[model samples]
Target: MKLYQPGDTSRAICPHCGKLVSTTFAYRDVPFEDGSGVVKGILAAVCDECQNVIAIPAQSTPAIRRARDAAEISLEVSIPAPEVEILDAAAYRVDPSATTRFRKSLFAFYLQRLRHSEETAEMLRRDFEAWNAVKTEQRKRVSRGIRIPHRRLSFKISPKTDRDVQWLMETSGMNKTDTVRSVVMEIEKDLLGPNTPRELRHLQDIAAVVNA
Candidate 1:
């Protein structure tokens, strides 16, 4: 009943091809029974040869069952009807379909605003690039098998510092841990500027070589 790790392989008889085939564990979005929602990144087994999908048995695993419950709750939660209507009015002008689309047409709609100039489009592009950079760094860390250990820290700070942290949290739309991590990284960059220790600099050079 344990969750399957990604890239784990196993031998399975293919139902369609009736041959012994290798299967790999992967994460995929699985639609719910009512078809109204999807469970994103659910554990699944995929046949390498036939590309067949086999969903993990959620009922058999307590952890998976809890995750399914959380996903179901997220799906069941509804936005206010009036707010949805207002959003739909603005959104439908571009795509008109109930389903969201991230195609070029939608991108063009943002680039050439219905009423305004290209400033908003530029801002959107800049924001997207920044987000993509952060995601790319995270992917690199994962690829390198870098583990960021989690430790509980309980401390007190000045009211001004607390307000600043709160403002950062609100502006960046990031949770406390991410906001703190970003702030720490910024401070570390400044501290490591020109006179960084030889050992640390050597480590950084090695990391650059590995990343290259």
Candidate 2:
């Protein structure tokens, strides 16, 4: 199967819009069953004009074969109940991305159904209210401009600790960075209660600077 390397662009007719468009090849995370797991290096053709994915037969054939093999292996293995629940939740989880197309598509689908049924309308109304609440909180944080900046931290750990981290990744469905952050939060809660004096002083300092 021929694949386009990085910095290569090919002209193709976009199936979605029926227009001749430039297709850019990029490596994207192809999720297995929504987002249960991701195959990190899948080659895909994305149309520049329509912002839609163009189907490539050669690339898809091998992916389909690998998916079948993985599915068979998954059926043969036994997963713990807690792990299974985590995997199930991960399947529907969405990451923060450049585009909200998936979310918009879901909203459109629900909105269409709502026109025919009162129950659907009620559900959609509640969903919007919940979403708005989250947005409102985020906006408040942004307006305050006192959010801590994230920094990269690196350290070496023993093999036992590495194994524990792997276990936490499986159980919590968090990447290593997030798992470490969660551990730190738990430790802080235990040691300093919900609000630490140091943190309060730091925030106060920032507030004073902003006020000035």
Candidate 3:
């Protein structure tokens, strides 16, 4: 999930209470230009419940460069949870070139929604169309593709450490693939013993990572 904007409010029907409620959730949206000169749009999912947000591409816009040196940057923003999901969906459909200008207007719509804003949402959509033309031209210059290999592997979560992807990323500092491979191998050795022969079944979960 991508992050919500700060101070952005949204209205939604509460599932738990079945009441129409409005609240603000905190999140961040940032745009990064990659080495290929391509700018990838990103959204972060900030959970207001615990104030934890994870950074990821807003939709699937690839980040051309590393986190630093991004062309356009925005701070963490807050919005209502339902609106946050709406914004997240919009991000998925947003064109990378117009990310900055479009997102700025989206923030305005977020504010309107908080105050019950249908008019404001309409206004924001108008601005989004206008901004797209300019940004699209700029993004064309830096289009390139970079590939990262993945292996499919799987393993049972150990009863001791439990299965937590975030914990492993934090502790191991290895990319997702390596971490999974290492954990699966360790589990296979422990569960089947070192003498267990290697075969399709033996590598069941582990193979997913390999194929991934």
Indicate which candidate wins on TM-score: 2
RMSD of each: 22.5, 22.6, 25.4
For residues 1-212, what per-residue lDDT tens digits would candidate 2 score against the true structure? 57567556888889898988898877665655533344556677778787666755376658755754454311012322322232222222322221222322222222232344445434434544464466458756776975434333333332334445555545545555544433333323322344433434433343344334
Model 3 spans > 4 angstroms off:
1-42, 47-51, 54-200
Q: lDDT for model 3, on a 0 to 1 scale?
A: 0.36
* Residue-by-residue lDDT tens digits, candidate 3, 1-212: 64446555555545454555564544344433222233333444333334333333344334333434343332232322332333333433333233323433333322222222445434433444454444345445543443323332222222222224434434445454433333333333333343533432433333333334
For residues 120-208, write the lDDT of model 1, one tens digit per residue: 33343345447547756875677597543434322333233444555554555555555444433332333334554334443334334
Better of 2 and 3 by TM-score: 2
Candidate 3 residue 167 Cα shift, in angstroms, is: 19
Better of 2 and 3 by lDDT: 2
Each candidate structure's TM-score, on Cα atoms with residue i matched to residue i, is: 0.27, 0.28, 0.19
lDDT of candidates 1 onward, in order: 0.46, 0.45, 0.36
List, in order, the clash count of every candidate structure: 0, 0, 30
lDDT of 2 at 43: 72
Q: TM-score for model 2?
A: 0.28
**Per-residue lDDT value at 36 in model 2:** 34
User: Which of candidates 1 and 3 is the stronger one according to TM-score?
Assistant: 1
Model 2 Cα RMSD, 1 decimal: 22.6
